[model samples]
Target chain A: MTEPSAKRGIAVEQAVVYGLLTALGLFAFVVALGYGLFLDEFRVGPGLVPAVVGGLITLIAGWELVATLRGQRTPHDKGLAEIVAAAAEAPPGGVSSDDDLPGGTLPSGEQAGEGTSDGVDIFGRTAAMRGRQLVIVFVALTVSVLLVPLLGFLGSFFLLSLFISAAVERRSWISATIVSFAAVAVIYLVFVVFLRVPLPAGLIGIGG
Target chain B: MLDNLVLGFSTALTPENLLWCFVGVLIGTVVGVLPGLGSTTGVAVLLPLTLSLEPVTGLIMLAGIYYGSQYGGTITSVLISTPGEASSVVTTLDGYQMARQGRAGAALAISAIGSFVAAIISLGLLVALAPPFARFALDFGPPEMLAVMILGLATIVSFAGDNRALGLLMALTGLLISTVGVEPGSGTSRFTFHSIYLLGGVPFVEVMIGLFAVGEVLYQIREGAAAPIRAGFRELLISKADLKRSAAPILRGSFLGFLFGILPGAGSTLASFMAYGIEKRVSKRGHEFGTGAIEGVAAPESANNAAANANFVPTLTLGIPGGATTAVLLGAFMINGIQPGPLLFDEQPALVWGLLASFFIGNVILLVLNLPLAPVFAQILRVPYGYMYPMILLTSLVGAYSISNSMYSVWVVLIFGIIGYFMKRLDLPMAPLVLGLVLGPLFEKALVQTSAIGDGNIGIVFTRPLALAVMALAIIQIVAPSLMARLLRRRNSSRARKADQAAEDKTEEHSHG
Candidate 1:
């Protein structure tokens, strides 16, 4: 019953992404054109390749946006399915739950959606929970990066670790503190003592 | 060849080189076992540290990480049905089943053996073929080189994702990003916007670390956590029967993986899947494939490892990356002031040969290490992600800053990390984008040279037979997949319509009766 809405939601998201990409492509195209796409015979300008590439990007991205609006499947949507469909058709032990297949594994031959993490499908979560966690993580990372110069690398990282472990993961303060310190110590030994990286030591001026 | 081998061993056998090699593989195993880290990120984040070492030593360690991750990925797959690397995805099919049936140790053992055998076989082929291929490539001029780069880009775009347009877009975007620095032919800065850091260009290693490390961490955090299965060391033994069944599949997978790996973008993941699919078709126990067939575990495991080794052929000889991880390795080459191409063989024979010999040594170390410690390695998964992810995040940011001791580099990592996160959510392939970025400078240089050679008529590509041949291949790569897919769709729909018509006819006759 909710399948159609879920699919529509994906389409809308894709439309937004493609729209932004189209804008970027157009901007690049215009900028490259301003730089003089072609110079003269026997020699091309610096902008020639960029102009062509930018124009192509604009066209393709715009076309993709339309296709998303039209609800059309991509030409290659079936590639991964074709490879693993035969195997997935049969159930090996009714392995359905995360607990059944450890390491948070997905079904057979599913494309590892992300390049890292190796094919674990972490979908089927409530949208609210996933969104909240993602937002929090992103915010935490931003704040940490902003704090790096001011608080110094190690000091800022220590607090970041504390926030993630204590605030995000909801661990006990003691455990979070322990984790944070351990992580900082390792970073110090590796980057500072061992490799001699000359990390920033902000106003506090420690662990440089 | 004999003298090259001697030089390789002598260089590789140094105490310092061997130590770094061990450190690399050991770290690689840990990186592979972790959820959000892979060899690409591992190499990138750790790359700055290696700059302190000798070039050959640094390269040997980095290559060790590449192949070591292949072995490490299987441990997770067999023990917990989780593939630590993309190429190991197929192993979970029969590998997990084996674990459920009290043969977890056997599954791990067989994978280690198969990977070792495949590495040996693929390395042999790489050693023999790469030099000759480089020698042949020396004859290529600007037009031919331009065609080759185009072919590389085309092949990657075709194979990277379901949407060819998306893949091409990402590649173009990478090329666009690569144009930020001053133009090679003319000293005009295209996209610097007047920043000092922008003059040098967006650092590729930092981008890689951001995309693969921090980006993956953010993505995985949303995934939360999962319970892992436990495998006891006492149960980790393989029977004689298991060995006999796996022998053929391992050999078949080795050759097949090597073939795929030599291509520009058909990576280890594809090779493993193909090997498993073919093994299923050919094996007499085909029906047992999904039900823990030993051959199933053996084939894919062997294929992924072989493919990992074979990826070096194109990377070392042609300067074109074999896959995403190798793209980062190519960046490492450039970071070390080394340019990889046909000239690399003659110019840096010691570094090249020494690096190759280390692969042989590294695999031997992996086999010996994995055989005794598969269960021990699986224990790493027990560490909570909460502790691990924070560390990874810190390392990525710090690593970026360490690259050139600039806050600008850190900012680039942070921005690209966000971009990578969004790309993952949208299912945009990262490999094509990375390959494009790595190839952009080389590609542009070729383009400019070709234009000069042909007096501004790029159409001269059609005149040279070698260039023409390569261009034809590029066109085929770009067009063939979609064409074949359309044909298949048509056939399927026609068959479906015929079946529907038969059903309607049967219903009409019944009503009349």
Candidate 2:
């Protein structure tokens, strides 16, 4: 990773920290005023302490902004220096994978850095496929919950087993169905018959 | 006592309660294994089902789940480093590090054994020390409670080392949020916003589920659920050296946990952190803290379990709830029409002893189950998040809605999830916040009652010997530990002290130099 120039890195860090301070300061100031105007107990209103605290935050933020702009750095607080140390001398500006970052992976392959593949459209396909996977899984879960009311425990679970295994579990059709059927049967017998917890009975009349 | 205990055993050893206990442990472990599920939500879901059974039976089930889940949680922390609950975060430091070194088996084995020893010691303390201990909690009337809470509030200043101001703000935010629905002094509702359900205020389970479980899901959703890190089953059990190293720390931690457990409002997590802190201070090895140390695992693990079990004393004896789980247990007591407090032994020896018997039964069951099942519980950490979160969202929706069957609550839970997510992202600890909220009303009520009893003077609190003792104990709880550490540093050999200089306060020292 190519390290960014010190000047450029410092400038970026200053902008980010100062920018956050300005935003938070403004938001807190406005909220404090609104609290005074609306909420009761204005003299010792719950908002009063919050407003004072918010004001202090804003002041420190403003102070930090000024110090950074002036380049009057404190001993313990080297915002830019810390960033440089962390980023280190690795391949600085390049994405390791187009589709992901370490903390949270992106849904699209274009994010992972392969736009140069002539007419490949890798990013769009990866993103679309990921999105489709989420939608299918969500639907399967929602269907299982909804079906619990109608198909009863046994039947609804059977269908749920099939859809989840087939769509999300990524298995052979027979294997998915078999696992689904068997698991649901176990849950059904344990919760319903053995425990005798009341369960919904469907048109199949399984509840007895 | 032995005959009564035997009789108690006879009562709890029945087929039905035993079966419920098994079911509870199984359900507890499942919920504990899942990231977005916890003992509180699990209890809330199953609490409704328990409404049909005898209160003792129901409580036995709930208690089983509460302790069982706590044990199950360490599995995740040690294996994948995805903490199953907030308290388990400390476990990850030593635990996952141990796992990475191919001693995962040792970590898992030692944790189960540590937890087992802690549970046994803690239960022994509860039975032996409960009555006289219950007498101590009674000393905390309003003024003393206020002072103690004030001190407890002061603890945030110390605990939130770097972010003191933000921590205080968050704490006050908790104290204030807890005061939202009702005016404890007056009959008037303060901030219900005209909703009937809001009058009940935010339920403890709802807030916990939102903050810990749902909050975490939001972070996971933001970061794709699949962690790149991996550790296999063979590496998951205990090594000989690991067991040898942890034995002493486990012994120390269990003792500490049981002592803290008797105190109202001091729960397992704090017990764990305190145990970790003490073990770090007192252990011959100091540098192994952030890096995986077996003592670190044993300390927190043992303390947390012992604390979890010890909390039962307050609920059983004083009728005053200690923590959230015990509060639920308190509800069970009230439902059973057997008021807790000193009268309990005289009025219903059978019921009380029987319940104690059940705890012993449950602890043994926990020991048996935790070792073999460590690998199984760890598997849930490996479950695809895509599969996990959807189910969490589904269960959360069902759990939140089912409480009052209210849609608005569902929305509130979601909104809190977003807020809770941001809190975690911003690096705020959620425990003290929850503890503040949970204890606030009780603190407020105690304060008012004491003031009234004293005819507005409040001097009666300190003037009373019992009250003074409790307040003194609370302060020592805060200061004594730190002072002892510094003293330990100062008195140790000069070379040792020089070696420990790195642990000294270094806030502006490096910067100035």
Best by lDDT: 1
Which portions of model 2 show Cα errors greater than 4 Å? A1-208, B1-4, B35-49, B136-141, B145-171, B174-186, B199-202, B228-230, B233-245, B263-265, B280-296, B314-355, B405-412, B459-462, B472-513
Q: How do the residues B308-327 of candidate 2 rate in per-residue lDDT, one tens digit apiece?
A: 88877766765545554555
- Model 1 alpha-carbon miss at residue A73, Å: 5.6
In candidate 2 the C-alpha lDDT for residue A45 amounts to 34
Model 1 lDDT per residue over A1-208, tens place = 1357655766787888889888888888888877776557856678877788778888988998888888885555434323342343232332232334432235322223322232232333454465577789888888987887689888888898899889877789999999899989988998888889999998787577
lDDT of 1: 0.81
* TM-score of structure candidate 1: 0.90
**Candidate 2 lDDT, A12-34, residue by residue in tens:** 56545555755555565555555
Q: Report the C-alpha lDDT of model 1 over B1-513, residue by residue, as the tens digit.
A: 989999999999999999999999988887777645678878887888787789999999998888899999888877766778877878888888888888888998999999999999999999999999999999999888889888888878877766678889899988888877888788878877898889888889989988888887776765555554456545867899999999999999999999878887667887887788778768877657767789989998999999999988889988999889999999889989998899999999999999999999999999999998888888898887766888788888887888788888888998888888878767788888999899988888888888887788888889999999999988997777757667656654675577568768888999999
True contacts kept of each: 0.33, 0.00
Stretches of candidate 1 exceeding 4 Å from the true structure: A1-9, A71-76, A80-127, B232-234, B483-513
Q: What is the DockQ of candidate 2?
A: 0.06
lDDT of each: 0.81, 0.60
Q: In model 1 chain A, which range of ten residues has the least summed lDDT? A: A109-118
